[model samples]
Target chain A: MHISLKPELLFNLGSFPVTNSILTSWIGTLLLIVIAIVVGGNFKRIPAGIQHVFEMVYEMFEGMATEVMGAAGKKFVPLLATLFLFIITSNWLGVLPGVGSLGIYETHAAAPAKDTHAAPAKDAQAKPAAKDAHAAPAAKDAHAAPAKDSHAKDDHGPVFVPLFRGANADLNTTFALAIIVMVIIHVMGIKSAGLSHHLAHFKNPLEIVSEFSKILSFGFRLFGNVFAGEVLLTAMASIFVIITGNNLLAYGALGGFIVFPFLMLEFFVGFIQAFVFAMLTLSFLSLFYKTENSEPHH
Target chain B: MLESLGINPVLMLAQAISFGLLYYVLNRFLFSQIRGALEERSAAVSKTLADKTEIEHRLQAFEQEQKAAQKKVAEEVQKMMLDAKDAAASTKAELVAKAKDAADAEFATAQKRIEQEKVAAEAEVSKHAKTLAQSIVQQLLSEKASDPQWQQEQIKASLESLKQSKS
Candidate 1:
């Protein structure tokens, strides 16, 4: 399987390449902007209708941030608020059944985040049941072009097929996020503490081995959660397809409705991840500086 | 990975960048403006309340002044009434004094007339008494002188005449 980083336009370099995912993202972004403008523009001393709704939302977010973070938390309100809105929006964008259904030059694609089989997975632990049900497809469609090599194998000339997908679906995206967050934590720690002092955390001869192990544990724990979540989603989607027939009449509609709640859950997960990443950085920085609330030696 | 996912990576990054930029711009222009306007409106309302309080204070002071002026006018009216009463009392007293003096003068004149009448009556009574005494004395003297000489002759004649007359 191969993943292409480069994408091509429909005709010329300046022309737009019509893909359903691209179209959906653009539509979502455009809608968000338009709503923001209509709500925010022509403001009155007394708020009414849409403006009032936005005000309430802002106040809610502001209150939550202050409650969780305290005085210091107020400074991070804007960042947290923006992150919350964007992540929820992106997660919900995929829930629409026809999000990437039609009006594209490319071959049939459904969700922008959908994987190889145009099917999503759910719960990796349920893979056994899902595999048994979906194994028939792989066996039957042996002649079908593999997703990774589809573009290359297409004999109808050299078609510059696009391969970039939603950043959240890929492990590279999650891993990169984890590493970036860790690096930011380290840099902040070092800045707060002298390099010598920061290094002293792991430099103690008595627990040097343990410190190295702890670092490994941290990385693995993060990777495990994110990877598992992606795989589980894939498997679940497959099982869903199998339970329903080739027609997939009932399950298809149910899946569309089911995605709404799952999207909400994913939105929550995204928020938790962002918060964990940020808080971890803050705590690490505090630790390096010996300013954090350390436990009593006794 | 694209084969396995049936999707692209470059498109994803592009999407992320687009979204991030859009958010940044909207936050800067729209949201912040609304927030600022709300703050300004709150401040203005508070300021207006303060101004209204000041005006009410001034009005209260004005009412107090008016009450004081009204009280002063009432006092002035009372003083005028007292003064008028005093003048009327003095004028009435003067009129009574004048009337008493005129009456005393009339009484004195009446007393003087009574004394004059008493003196005149006394003089007239004494004169009448003197005249009556003189008449009685003359009659008695005439009777005594005639009777002694001619007493015997005449007495006899007259006695005869007197007896005749008496009979």
Candidate 2:
């Protein structure tokens, strides 16, 4: 069976259907709550070992959120901090061998993102003519079998399972995140500018179409960035398989070791994406809704 | 494609709304407590530092006053000692003057007594000498009574003649 960034594994209960992306999101959510609970459980005047570390992290997140989101973000610190912690945790969690490499019901699947087949065959050029004759029939048979068994019930087809997976790798997840952020932006705008003024941004008689173009661009920018990152990471790991003749997990591991620098990039990208999402929403809201007495630049 | 796994937009929105609500509620309770505790702890520490500084300042002032008091006490003791010395000298001078006056009066009285004794003894001695001279003169008058008057007159005349001659 072909491997892919399968978000479906999380949504199923036995034969019942459930969304993997949602499942992963829920796991991320629970993980955040657990961390918050653990960190915040013991309250004392003098912070001790683990609490000290957690407090520093909390303070750092608070500072970043306030810096990016501004004074208005003071109230939203917990929410933004929670989101940042959860998303990063889920993404990093996908690097674990059991979570990223282990396939549900025992198969080599795209652990974090669905694997892609995009490597140019290096040896194909060595004996192309002779290899083509032998490979053509196999390819034809492969195409014909899917058509023959389209309605046949297969127990081992693409299905959902409950496990850890990359939350941003799934389009539904990123799309949902984007939409939520946008909605929050609108809500914030409305809260700041009031209904009429906030809506005025979209209701320009001369530039109504341009307003829509701007909105589309804003959403698409976030969508494209996260989507492309997931796709690229998937592609890089898949290439390791073609060159090294290993399973997706082995390739993923090898790719991780070789392309570790890229993973670091991914880490930073993930943080920026999260910050951008929150900041854009905040800015959009402030621009539309902020009172005249508020910061003039906003 | 993900619809097979129930990746519905409706469900996504529903999940987001529910989580957001949950987060908001939890934040109101949990986050508020944590944030409040941290703020309170910091405030307490600041208050403690302020209190410590205040006490220290008061203590410093008290110490300064104590040092001044000690200095004043030493000065007072020195003044008292000087006064005592002055009193002792004055008393000694008065005693010495009284003793010298008494000695001078005793010496004067003794000298006056001695002079009076000498005068009295001289008077007695003169009287005795006069009596002896009278006895001696009576004896001599017995022997030469006529000659005494005559000699006295003659001597007076002769002394007058001699005085006229000499004059």
Candidate 3:
């Protein structure tokens, strides 16, 4: 089973190396835009079919916004709804049969060398004490073996790079979403409470830390959930393949039995995570705006 | 760590731009229109409700007016009927009294005429009787010229009957 923390680079458009997750997100954006155009182009007083579904989603989010922010919440519906749609679509698209599985076998040499250099640093940062104590020799041994091999073979080994990955699985996309939401929240706060009042919240260092933590939590929570779901599905499918002794027919027949439930679980998790993300943003917005009323009641 | 996880600033910026575009499109097309439609529909509904209430009130007022008019008409009709009855009664009484007075006057005139007729007839009868008695007395006196004692006796009997009748 192959799992990568980073999305596979599909191709470059000029200097921008478009990754699989970016491509998937573009597809999601296109899908949403088309839906919006279709639904928005010919709105009926009496909604039907896809229009009805869209209205239902609009109403649901509007109701949630109202519940969170009262009348003012309505203004934030577009952002929150877009976030929900974009995230959920990306997540569900990630789990499609071909998304993670369908790929080209490119040699590792085609991959960026930067990823290799960054991996050890990331590992060291993630487990500094453990790496320094227990895993130091093991890490050296791993590097030594790769070094012992003819560098060309080790570097040019064929790697399966999927054409599409879940958009939220990429930290860039989630972080982008998080940053956008946080920035908007602050802007709204400043607009409503004045710059001085809005900035005054940072008087407490904990509050400053909280603001940064909010971004991290928002981004990682979504990325982790979607990425973990993908991993779980991959692991389950691989386990099925191993159990079937690499027999394609047996794998196909038994894979459903093992992986189908997890697929359903992934679907549930995708929707819940999307809802949670949007809800938390709404809650934070309400909380941030409520600072005006935060004075101690005498 | 971020680089290892492929958190490119350009990609992040691009995603944010994409999201911003989506928000703009959705806000412009879907949300604004729906909100407007909902507001318009609600306004129309409230207006229709207000109109309905106004119509109901007017209908109630019209009904009350109709009822009052009907009552007034009934009362007027009753009053007119009573007046007509009273007029008819007075007219009938006046007619009856006039009829009674005319009948009494005719009776009195007839009674006076009858009395005059009866007096005339009585006077004629008495004159005729007197004339017949005188004729019979003259004949008896002529037949009894030779009988002076019989004539004296007839005269005496007439005188005695006259005196007895007078008494």
Candidate 4:
């Protein structure tokens, strides 16, 4: 069971570093596109088949949003709906067969790339929680990188690098989503309620601090929940391997019997986290609209 | 680990851009179209329902008018039949009265003509009897010396007998 605090670098795109989370998220986006096409493409006035299912789901969310946000919710439905789909799909992406488990080994020379690639390895070794993750994949690694003798020089040899990771599991992606949500909320507040009214939400010092803290709260809440689920599943898988004396058959049995259950848990966790995030944003936005529309308290 | 898993500035911005783009594109393509189509269709359906109700109301009213018109026509036909019957009854009564008057007049006229003819016939009979009596009397006088009183008595008795016969 490997658990890293940070997402591993899958490959380099010229100068920019592409993390595994980014890859998975892109795949999630592509999947969303495909879903949109299948659901919304051959749409009719009267729906049937896949279109019916899609419309039903959309209407459900729309109804909920309208219930919460009232008339303004009619406009904000797309935002909430998109967030739910994106987060839920990306969260569930980790549960696929070989998400955190399988990957190519990134074995570049530690000396040359060490300065540029300090983020992943350095962040991993620095964190106490990442110690187990570092140790678990190191022993089972195959020498896929160019040089084998060069690995013996450093304390760390080739590390198992997964091609994709859950986007919600990465703190970076979740934080980004959180920040974007906050910015949108504030902007919408200013737009709906005027700048003075929106700014007045921070009348007290503690209120201002609390509002600012929402950035980290929103980001880490999603990141921690999803990442913890990932780590738990990985740890359970590892325990299965250790118990079965590294037998592949026993591992499968443990997975089907035990690990599979947590995967289901993770699935729920993913769905719930997505729901919470979107709903929180929706509720918060609703509040902003309410505050904006209501008479000012002297 | 929490420190490492914490938010990063650069990555947060990147994700923000990604989310924004995805939201914008999806909203434009998928959701807006759904709302538009759904709203338009519902409006059309309601409009059609309203139109249907209106047409039904009109049909009911028209049917009611047709029924009233039919009733009126039936009543007129019955009244016309009654009027024709009354006219026929009155004409029959008048024709019967006229026919009875014409028969009475014809009978009266025929009675008057019979009386006149009877009077004329009696006068002619009287003249012929007078001539026959005179001739008889002259022949008797010539035969047995002038018996005027007896001829007169015979003539009076014959005339009396003729009157009794006529009665």
Candidate 5:
């Protein structure tokens, strides 16, 4: 099994390397947008169906935000709610059946050489041996020659690059979210307590460190949780495959017995991580606003 | 290190833009609309409740007024009945007195008519007696010229009796 910390590069969009995680982020964004339009397009005082579900989710986040930040938090409900929804959607989408498993084979030469870690390269080279052993009897002869030829050419073989990755699994997406939220928080802080008062908090060295650390904490907390979950599932799946010896029936049964529980665990983790991210942002906002309110005005 | 972790500036910016777009869409469609609906529904409910309370109070007052008016009307009817009864009693008494007076006046007129009739009858009777005695005296004088003094005495006696009865 090939596992990497980085999301696989899907393609280049006019010099921009479109990673799988960003693509998944876009999908999550599009899904949210569609739901927003659908629910927001024809609003009723009495909600039903998908509208009801949407309202329920919205109210849940809204309630949490309001509870955390008081009435001032009412205005930030959209941001908090979007973050929760997008993160959860992307996380859950990552755990889907074909998300990490389904992808095109990219030869090591054709693949981007930027993020070639030794461990993943070794894993990629080892994957073909495992694949040959698991190949069907009818197709083994047909695939063996190519597999041998590819192995003969280079020490490294083709790497399996997934077309989709969990958006939070990528540090870029999580860091982006963290940066945006922190920026907004600071902007709000400045707006509530004049620029000088807001900036004055940075006078203390620890305060500055804490401010920067918050971004790292926010970004890595999500990225680590999601990335770890992906790694755990991959490890568990590889174990199941090894135990079943590539037998389809035994693999299916072992996967159901072993991987299913972990999948459930991942699902729970996904939601918890999303909740943590949102609640943390809300709490931080509350803290900023609370300090702003408590401080004497000039 | 960031590149190894697959953190790209362009992708982060893109994700941020996507999130910003999502936020704008959600704010426009979901949060604002739901908040407005909730506020509107709350206001409508309170207004309706207020209107209901006002109507209930008015209804209660109206019922009380209706009850009071009913009581007043009943009292007025009772008073009118009493007055009518008293007026009827007085009118009956007055009519009885007037009827008694009229009966007394009619009895007096009948009694006076009776007295006048009695006097006229007696006078007619006396006149008839006088005429009969005169005829008897003339017949007797023709039969016996010697008995004139006795016939005159008889006529004088009859005239004395008639005068006593008239008096």
Candidate 6:
């Protein structure tokens, strides 16, 4: 119900405004690092223990690369692997309790309120009504912090803005990933096929035209999946509270039944979106290579 | 205000930089090691297979050589046994013939000696008969003054007896 298109800005690092999504990505990066070190530290030639699991994951991407690129596909494994691992982990970060839930709230006086108010008109009317009931009687700071017993008895705590948001849910992260993929693909193509041959792909103006669509498709697809999932879960939680009218019952229903299933569903979606993005990149890379090779035949 | 969901260039650049960093770090940590292991494993497997085939070939050749040596020894032993049998048979025949020749010579010598001894005894007996007859004739002559015809008749009869014995 508190759906915002942009990730909330947590703090400013010099001129760079670091958002909650960036924070979550940093978490994902840290998680990946710890696992890599732990797994890499004990790396054995025989590939037993965690190394085995790591190898399986590594091999999965290798197979995808090989499927499209044949023996030459092995070269792209690292890039594809990094993409899948980072995206999937960042996507799943949304489901954590404090991830989208706890934050330093910067309340935009006009916009946030309008989004909450406009929620009913666009989608379900009662959804925002339920969110309002869940948020607080006061529009702004009542949910920001736990104040006093006098205020606690009157209403539920302050409406919180999360300090950490799902990285994939943010346009910045998805677009960045997509742009990076395109850049890598183009670079790889140029490296393999030479600059002239690579540019020949846009000989048809339509090909040039499609590149824009490609960006939208790739970035938006990932962003939509992850962002909508967060919205879906938050809405589902609010729905239960609204229906039950008892805070405890709603929390139980959200945590126990409705949200739990959706959370599990989101995990698979996260993995699948990651897989799709990586595979698409690999496929594009393979196509480039294929043409690069076939052009000689032509 | 940057629209919340709208793409931000600065943020996108930031994310790109982060992604690039992640890619570099991850490649160093995981991908390189796994790839090296994979290549090493492949090489090892192929090497093992090659060595196995080579060993099998050597074993087969060795087995063939062993069989040939065993066969040659068996043939030599068979030849030696046949030679021994032939030598033993020839030696047995020679010993039998030598014994037969010795026995024949001894029998011929014994026969000659028997014949000589028989002749000698007969001659001695004849001599004794002639001497006894002469003595009888002299005694008769003295008694009858002269008996030449009686003595001649006795000598003729003895000579006839000797002739019959000789025949």
Best TM-score among the predictions, by candidate number: 3
Instruction: Report the C-alpha lDDT of model 3 over B1-167, residue by residue, as the tens digit.
Output: 77667778999999899888888887788777777766787799999999999999999999999999999999999999999999999999999999999999999999999999999888898899889988997887788877989879989999999999999
List residue ranges in candidate 3 displaced over 4 A.
A110-156, A243-247, A290-298, B62-167
Tens digits of lDDT, candidate 6, B93-125 = 777777777777787778877777778777887
Chain A TM-scores of each predicted structure, in the order given, are 0.49, 0.64, 0.81, 0.80, 0.80, 0.78
lDDT string for model 4 (A144-215, tens) is: 332222223443555566666889888888888877788888898888888998888888999878777988
lDDT of each structure? Answer: 0.48, 0.55, 0.75, 0.71, 0.74, 0.71
Instruction: Indicate the residue-level lDDT of B65 in model 4.
Output: 95
Q: Candidate 5's residue-wise lDDT over A106-203, tens digit each?
A: 56564454332312232233322222122222123223334332112353445455666788999999999999999998898888877887888788
lDDT of 3 by residue, A141-213 (tens): 3344443311224643444455677999999999999999999989988887889978987999999999999
Instruction: For model 4, name the residue pairs that clash.
Output: none
Decide which is better by lDDT, 5 or 6.
5
Best by DockQ: 5
lDDT of 5: 0.74
Report backbone clashes per prediction.
21, 11, 0, 0, 0, 9
Candidate 6 residue lDDT tens string, A49-121: 7778768778998887766676778888988889998998898777664566544333344223212222222
Q: Write the per-residue lDDT of candidate 1 for residues B38-150, one digit (tens) a residue.
A: 55876898999999999999999999999999999999899889888988888878777777777777777777777777766766676676666666656755676576865
Candidate 4 ranges beyond 4 A from true positions:
A34-43, A46-50, A111-156, A244-248, A290-298, B1-3, B59-167
Model 6: DockQ score? 0.41
What does the lDDT come to for candidate 6?
Answer: 0.71
For the record, the alpha-carbon RMSD of candidate 5 to the native fold, in angstroms, is 10.7
Assess the local accuracy of residue A126 in candidate 6 as a C-alpha lDDT between 0 and 100: 27
lDDT of 4 by residue, B65-152 (tens): 9999999999999999998998898888888888888888888888888888888888788888888888997787787556677778
List RMSD in Å for every model shown.
Answer: 15.1, 10.5, 10.5, 10.2, 10.7, 10.7
Listed in order, the DockQ scores are: 0.10, 0.10, 0.52, 0.32, 0.54, 0.41
A-chain TM-score in candidate 3? 0.81
What proportion of the true contacts does each candidate reproduce? 0.22, 0.11, 0.75, 0.55, 0.89, 0.67
- Which 10 residues in a row give candidate 2 chain A its minimum summed lDDT? A127-136
